[model samples]
Target: MSNHRQAKDPRLQKISSQLAAHGLILRGGFVFGDGEAALEPSEARPAKSVLLVGQAGAAPWPYFLGWREQQPRDLQNPLDTWSREVIDMVAAHFSAWTVYPSDKPYQPFQQWAMRAEGLKPSPLGILMHPEYGLWHAYRGALLFADEIPIPDIHDPIHLCDQCVGKPCLKSCPVDAYSGDGFAYQSCLAHVRGTDGEPCRAGGCLDRNACPYGTGYRYPADVQAFHMASYAGL
Candidate 1:
């Protein structure tokens, strides 16, 4: 798994700190394969390494909210828009290319995340973080023409394995998730229905029921925003 350069690079630290100032974290990165691995923009140089960027908990909420206020009225996909603008700025500063999860041709961000962070999926299908639990996300990434020193990934214990009761599977009123798998349509219906107010307002009861990382759980408004998006409200 440890394949990249072992040299200490200051650029990684600088890039990480810069992104953190904007409520983003360097989730992890990897050296690219010969000529191709990910979908690169046409204008991009021969990318040698890719650095995944993302948010943990509610870290980016306040910053995003502040930025959203100054944006034009009726802005669409405001969060993704903000993430792009912010990450793009970092990319430019560091002489890198920016790619997003929602980009055309759809970049393999989930796979990249797994490679970078060594995280596995939860029952909810979201990659469960060791500390942030389900409250983290991959926003976008920066691509560099030269491979940088990627830090080693220390695979942490999967939190779900330690939970005996598995409250996340039980808290859903509709039993949207079961041994058969997630009932997406059923979950959607409940979230948009009259009885879904609790879930709509405070987020997925099942997701909230997870015992790990309570301190990192997103705020109610943030969860509501995501739920609204999920239900297409």
Candidate 2:
């Protein structure tokens, strides 16, 4: 007897369910046709697929801290390990895979999924998990053989609606995040400046003020690393 499984296998559903149980959310979409065009001058192609982004929830924070803090000297190792595990799992469910930072210029795979299926950005970002406050990130993504079914993209709920203090836009010592948009250069200057302030010593003041994801927040060092990376330091 021979094992017979369809190429577009239903087993993917089981795998996805398992991932969800582990706090990883699966998002599907097509590979952007202009992958090379989206690359930055200093950045290399990170992967070669449409992308399936996975993010673990706040429930994983304790586990995340175990690797993120205790092994501070080897931070990248654990992050890389977890990210690759997600990539591999997604790849198994899809035809191809690619992993990149969500902050990258490349269109979000969720947006791509919508466009491919004739959709729009609605009001909110995709996968409207109520707690992450747009702070959660896409750790890795995978590309697939066919389009996957996703909830009709809805408008993102403006977190500002519920935030009484709106601290994220106000906590910045330099007011980097305006109600309208970010003052990227100003933020970078403040973080890297010789002000010798608590923001520099701790992490992004604006990000820390986000009321959501209080439990899932990135460790301070991780926040600093990301802020420094954004500052091009």
Scored by lDDT, the top model is 1
Stretches of candidate 1 exceeding 4 Å from the true structure: 34-38
Q: Mind giving the per-residue lDDT tens digits that candidate 1 earns over 1-117?
A: 337657877888888888989888989888876655645568746777889999889999989999999999788899999999899999898889888888878788888898888
Q: What TM-scores do the predictions have?
A: 0.93, 0.59
Instruction: Compose the digit string of candidate 2's lDDT tens values, residues 1-233.
Output: 11223254464576577566546665543333443434322334333334355563444444455645655563544655666665675566544545455435654555554443333321222233345544455556554444343333344454555668766666777776664566767777777788725665566776677667677676666665555555645
- Model 2 stretches with alpha carbons more than 4 Å out: 1-12, 17-24, 27-51, 57-89, 99-105, 108-129, 151-157
- Candidate lDDT scores, in order, read 0.88, 0.53
Candidate 2: what lDDT?
0.53
lDDT at position 32, candidate 1:
74
lDDT of 1: 0.88
- What local lDDT score does residue 201 receive in model 1, on the 0 to 100 scale? 96
For candidate 1, the 10 contiguous residues with the lowest summed lDDT are 32-41
